[model samples]
Target chain A: MMSLRSFRDPVLVALSLVALWQVLHHIAGDSAITAPAPTLTHLWEMIGQARFLPHLRETGLAFLQALAIACGGGILIGVVLGGHRLTGEVAEPILVGLYSVPKITLYPVILLLFGLGMPAKVAFGALHGIIPVVLFTMNAVRNVNRTYLRTGRTMRLAPMQTAWFILIPATLPEIFTGLRIGFSLTLLGTMLGELFASQRGLGFLLMTAIELNDVKTILAIAVLISAFAVLCNAALLAVDTRLHRGAAPETSGK
Target chain B: MKKATWIRTVFLVGALGALEVACRSGAIPATMVTAPSAMVTTLVKTMQSDEIGGHIEQTLSAVAIAMALSITGGFAIGFILNWFPVLRRAFAPFLAAYYAIPHFAFYPLLIVIFGLGSTPLIVLATLFAMVAMIVATMTGLDRVPRVLLKTARIHRLSLLDEIWRVRLPAAAPHLLSGLKLAVAYSFIGVIAGEFILSTSGIGHEIAFAYDNFDNPRMYALILFVLAIVTAFNMTVYAYERRLMRRRGI
Candidate 1:
C-alpha cells in the first residue's frame, strides 16, 4: 500500500502538470501556447525531420566535449587543491563567488576570446559546469576519513595506489553528485550559447521559432529539451542515490 | 583581517595588474578585453552621461519585484506543502529536478502571455527564483526543533505567535540562505532574459555594445553588474557569518 501510494503520487503530479498545460493553452489561446497533445505530436514530427538531426548532433557534440573538460579539469584541480589545505582555502570563496554569478553576463567575453562557433559554446558550457564539480570534489577529498589515508600509508601503498584504492572509492559518491549538477548546468549554458549569435543547434531553432512567433515549434522544442534534461537527470539521480547509499554503511562503521 | 582574506585580496589585485599590463602592452588585444582601469573609467563616463541610468533602474526594479514575489510566494507554497505530507512527497522529485530544465525556453511563452517589456522579465525571474526559496523554506521548517513546539504548546501560545517566536528563530539560518539564493537567481533570471531579447536593461545594453564592437562600454557594464552582485553577496555572507557566530555555530 505504501509503495502503491508513492507510485500513484508521481503519476498524479504528472497528470496535473498536463492538465495545467491544457488549462494554460485554453487561457493563452492557440497562438500563445499549443496544447500538450499537439506539442508532443510536434515534438515527434521534429524528431523525425532530417534538418533537426544536425542541430541535435551539433548540440550533442558540444555538450559531450564540454562535459569532458568540466569533469576532467574539475577533478584534477579539485584533487590538487584539496590535497593542499591552503590552496583550497584561498580558492574556495572565489569558486563560490563564481558559482553564484550569472555567468550569462560573461558570454560575450567568452565569444570574444573563443570566437563564434563550437569552441565558444563548449567553453561556455565548461565554464558553467566546472566550478560546482571542483567545489564538490574538493570537499569530498577534504572530508575523506584520515584513517583511510593512514591505513594506506601503513600498508606502504604508493601515492597512485592509495588514490585508486582509498581516495576514489571514498569520494566517488559526492563527486558523482557534482557531475549530475554539472551536467544540467552545462546543458543550460550550451543552450544559452546557441540562443544568441549562433546559426545552428536546438537553441538556435528555439530562437528562430521565437522570432517567427511559431508557438507550436517553440513549445515542441522546449518540450524536447525538457524531456531530455529530465530523463538524464533522473538517471543520474538514481545512480547518485545508489552510490550514496552504498557509501553509507562504510562511512558509518568508521 | 584573516590570512586567507589578505592573500586572496593580493592574489586578485596581482591578477588584475597582470591583465592591465597585458592589455596595455598589446600582448592581449584591446578588441578582446580592455584593462580593468579602463573599464572603470568607461563605467564612470557612462554614468556621468546618465545614458544607462534608465536601463539600470529598469533592470534593478524588475529584479526587486521578482525577488519579493519569489520569497513571499515560495514561502507560502512551502509552508502549505509542509502541512500536507502527500503533496510534499509529490513535489519532491519535481523540485529536485527543477533546475535541470532550460527555463529560458519558456521566456518566449511568457513574452506571449505577459507581453513585452519588464512584465515578462519579472515573471521569468520570479519563476526562476521561487523554487530555491521553497526548498529552503521546507528544509528550514523541517529542522525546527520539536521541543520548541512542545514549549509553545505548554505556554498555550497562539499559532501565529509560536511561528513568529520559536519556529522562525529556529529556522532563520536556512531562510537566510534561501533569501541569498533568491536574490542571486533573481538577478540571473532578469539579466539573462534581458540579454536574450529585451528592449532595454543593462543586459540589453551589454548585448548591444557587444554587437556594435563597443568593447569598453560592454566591459564596463559587465564589470558593473558583476561588482554589484559580488558586493551584495558578500554583504549577505557577512550577515550569515554574524548570525552563525551569535548562535555559537
Candidate 2:
C-alpha cells in the first residue's frame, strides 16, 4: 500500500484549497465569517501580544499533571491486573464496558466533586485518559509470548531479570501506542472540562469568541489548536517510531 | 470463566450497593452523588414523561444522520486517497495529526458557518466519525487481495460485479469496525454539541439538570446514556463476534 508518490500533489492540493477559500471570501464579503487572511493575521497578533500563553499554560499544566498520574498509575495497575491471568480475564470485560461509556458523561460528576477549577479539569483529563492506557498496557502484558519467558528461564535469568529484559521489551511498542492514545485523550478531557465550566483556558477563549461572534478570532484559535494537535502528535510519533524502530515495518501497513 | 463472570457480577452489585449506602449515609453529599434508588425512580419518571423521550429522539436522529454521512463521505475520501498515492502521501502527516486534537474544539467555527441548530451538530459528528472511517476504508480496500482481482478478471466480471462480489466482502470486516467507531463517535459528537450549544437533546437535558442542580434528573440522564451506550456496545460486540466465528477466525 505504500506506493511511490509524487511530491507535488500535496502542495497542489493545499494551494487549490487556499485558492478556493480566497474565492469564497470574495463571494461572501462584509459578513462576520472569517477569511483565511484575517484569521492568520489575528493568530499572529495574539501570539505577538502573548495573550495565548496564560491559557496555553493553564491547559498544558493540567494536561501534564493528568498525564503524569495516568501514565504512572495506569501502567502500574494495568501491569498488575494483566500480569495475572485470572484478574486479567475478570477485568477485561468490565474495562471494555466502562470504556464504551462516553467519558465526557462523567464530567458533571468530576465538576461536582472537584468544583469549577484546575483540579476538576485535571481529574477529568486523567479519567478520560487512563482507560486506554490501562487497556493497552494490560493487553501487552497479557499477550507477551510465552516463548520469551521460556527462553529467559532456560538462560537462568531471575524472575525480575526476565521481567525487565524480556517482558518490558516485548511490551514497549504497545505501551508507546497506549501513551500516544492516552495523551490525545488527556488533551480532549482537559478541553472538555474547560469548555464545560472553566473560567480560563483555550476552550474558554473559544467559547468567549463564539459568544462575541468574533469569527476571525474563533477561526484563528481553531487553526492554532489544530496546529498544536498536529505538532504534538508528530512529536509523539517521532518518539514512538524511535522506540519501535525495528518493529516499524511489521506494524506500518495496517 | 463462570467464576470470573460470577465475580464480576458480584463486584458490580457490591459497588452499587456501596454507593447506595454512601449516598444514603451522607458520606457523600447528596448534591454530588444521587442515591441509586433515587436514580431509578427518576429514570422511571422520565420514561413516563415525554420530555426525556423528545431529547432521546433528537440525540438519536442527529447521531444516525451523522453516522450515515460520515460512512459515505469517508468511503469516498478513502477511495480517492487509495486511487492517488501522491495525495495520500502528502496528506498523511496532516491526517495523523488530527487524532491528537479534540474535534469538538472546531465546533465554534462550525456554528459560525452552519448556524445554530442540528446542522452544526451533525457536521461535527460527521467530521469526528469520518476520520476513522476513512482510515478503515483505506486499509480495508488495501486488503483486497490481488488474487481476488485476478480471479474477477479471469471470470470476466464487470466492475460493479467485481466490487460487490469480491471487493466488498474483502473489506467488510474493516468497514464494519469503522462503522462501529463511527457510531460511537457520532454519539459523542452529537452529545457534546448539544451540551455546548443546543437547546434540546439529551446532552442539553444533562446540562440543564446540572445547571439547575436537579441531581436526580442529571444522574438519571447519565444512567440512561450509559445504558444506551452499553447496549450499543454489546450489540456491536456480538455482531463482531458472530462475524469472526463465521469467518472461522
What DockQ, between 0 and 1, does each candidate earn? 0.67, 0.53
| Candidate 2 residue pairs that clash | none
Candidate 1: residue B110 lDDT (0-100): 91
Model 1 over residues A1-254: C-alpha lDDT tens digits? 96687668867998999999999999999988899998899889989999999999998999999999999999999998888988999999999899888898999999999999899999999999999899999999999999889999999999999989999999999999888888888888888899988988888999999889898998898888887887787679778988999899876686
Clashing pairs in 1: none
Docking quality of model 2: it rates as medium
Q: TM-score for every candidate vs. truth? A: 0.94, 0.89
Model 2 — TM-score against the truth?
0.89
For candidate 2, write residues A1-254 as lDDT tens digits: 22223335545665786787677667655354557887799899997777778998888899899999888888998998888877887898898777657777778888899988899999988987898899999998887778778989899998899979998888998888798888877877888888887888888988887777677877787778777876787678767867788656645543
Report the poorest 10 consecutive residues by lDDT, candidate 1 chain A. A2-11
lDDT agreement with native, every candidate: 0.91, 0.82
Q: lDDT tens digits, residues B60-133, model 1?
A: 99999999999999999988888798999887767767776778888888988888789999999999999999
